[model samples]
Target: MDIRQYIDSTYLKTPAMAGTTIKENNEVVRSLVNEAVANGYKLVMVRPEMVAFVKRLLCVEKSKVLIGTVIDFPEGEGMLFKKLDEANKSIYDGADELDFVIDYKAFKRRDFEKVKTDVIECTRLCLDHKKIAKWIIEVAALSDKEIISITALVKNVVLTYFSESDYFNVFVKSSTGFYKTESGKPNGATIHSVKLMLENSFPLPVKAAGGIRNYEDAVQMIRLGVKRIGTSSASEIIAGEQVSDEY
Candidate 1:
């Protein structure tokens, strides 16, 4: 299936958590970008600040691996303008795809309008800039019904505002890989959650993120019709190795 093409090799750790210095963290991102290019992975997902650095590195090396960054990150409680600002900067800094963490807090609170507006603005910004947009609904934090409703909500907004050709450009992604559950449960992509997302967001592409550790799991996601799989285990999966990392 040329799994490399559907994999987004990702590293979204903060500088402090990732390294002691900016140089050290950037070196990590650079290594990831280099590895992605060499391995023919589809993209390298990094923090927003690292987008420009990755872009410059790719330019110098003449690599075609896409640069993707997260917006609103693990927490989607930021104000709309702030999220948009982050998105704009990432795009200006050469991010080709933006994975936005939608305001699930608002959705859970039954503030559907707020949630819808948040998604619409961020997605429209990506559309205006001709960049890929994926909404990270943080499935692990929600119930089955919540997942279905939110996925459908995102689909409705995209179809309402965009053309058919642009549907694939917008995706309903599974998780942010950083959400904490009260029970300390696994807070990443699961087959059941992904199945719900796919069934609800049919025309819009679905990206299964988090908890996808091996090639077999990735292949299963593809079989479920996921367009992308986001994980730090991309290299391991591609090489047919199993790792114990949760990203």
Candidate 2:
């Protein structure tokens, strides 16, 4: 596999999040965008505010690197309208794909109705705009049964509301790369979690994000059927090396 094509070259940390100065953070985002464009990675994931800036960079270079931004990010508890507003703004800012963090907390609370509405609205927004949509179901926060249930929930939502032609554009993404967990447990994508997602969300591709720090792990995800990988370690992975930066 040409692993580069499967990468969602990512850097979602803000200045405060990374404890860096704003200039430093901008440089990091710029460098990541340039590197992704140079490497021809499938996409470059960034914060919603940076989507337009990244789009301008790609436009200047005439690059094909798709621009992806998160909606309602690490926390998916934003009111439905808030999430839609954020997604609409990002889409207007030239995002090619929007990875919306599903209201997993609601799902955990057994509010499947809320989860269904979240999926229906966000997924439809993306599909209507002819852009890729990914639903991030923060796996670290859920149990095995919850993971299975949530994945199936997304699959059913898309398959039920959207046409088959739209299936490929909708994805059940694994994490936001920003989920907090107790005791430093794996807070990002795990084989077990991703496996459940793939088994349940088949046909709608899965994008495994967060905590995937090495080439072996990236390839393993692909081998297990993930259509995309969102990671901060794309360069190291391309160089076939492992690094210890948790996304």
Candidate 3:
């Protein structure tokens, strides 16, 4: 399939503590949402506090942007109840979709049951609010075995939620863009994780993120079975800076 048709998912990951500042993250979120809409990007991941502001800013017939706010981003080790409350608030605040991080420690400890329950609760929160839920398995922290296991666990939750809820998302993300080195490439672990998510979950859509700096990488990721490419470089990708000579 041609990669250009794929959507470029993104996030406005302002610091959680930005509310302490004078301008506040909400203003930043509003400005960013307007710019993104003006630029033609449709999906953006936002913080809980910014959800309502972004929804209003991007809600237009010409824009039609969708908001996907993160629950316990970067690290999913927060209390499940707290995450659910955050998700609930985001939905109430007007988020169109929800993206939540799974607790890595739970997965590493082989606590599949805990993982399942947490996701179920999260999904339940979304369902109760009538919103879409996208489970973000931070693939950077898991090993290959752990990745596959988590994928299975997500598949199970997705199936369960779909039967009971509006929709289920099986997006295995690369990284939160929090970890970086001089190389600045998405970790090999994340790549393997995406490969596994795509191979194991054929019918389920995969969202590849992190270190997606160019269009060629985006297209290549789609060829590797990713249905959506999440990156901070959405403008670059849309501007054709990421494409290659052949394209």
Tens-place lDDT digits, model 2, residues 106-152: 99889999889988998889988999999999998999999999999
Tell me the deviation in Å of residue 107 in model 1.
0.2
What is the RMSD of candidate 1?
1.1
Q: Residue 179 of candidate 2: its Cα lDDT?
A: 69
Lowest lDDT 10-residue stretch of candidate 1: 178-187
Off by over 4 Å in 3: 1-5, 15-28, 60-62, 164-170, 180-191, 242-247
lDDT of each: 0.91, 0.90, 0.66
Per-residue lDDT over 66-104 for candidate 1, one digit per residue giving the tens place of the 0 to 100 score: 999999988889999999999999999999999999999
Error of 3 at 119 (Å): 1.3
Q: Clashes in each model (backbone N, CA, C under 3 Å)?
A: 0, 0, 2
Report how far off residue 52 is in candidate 3 (Å). 1.1
* lDDT assessment of candidate 3: 0.66
Report clash pairs, candidate 3.
215-242, 216-242
lDDT for position 154 in model 1: 97
Candidate 1 yields a Cα-based lDDT of: 0.91
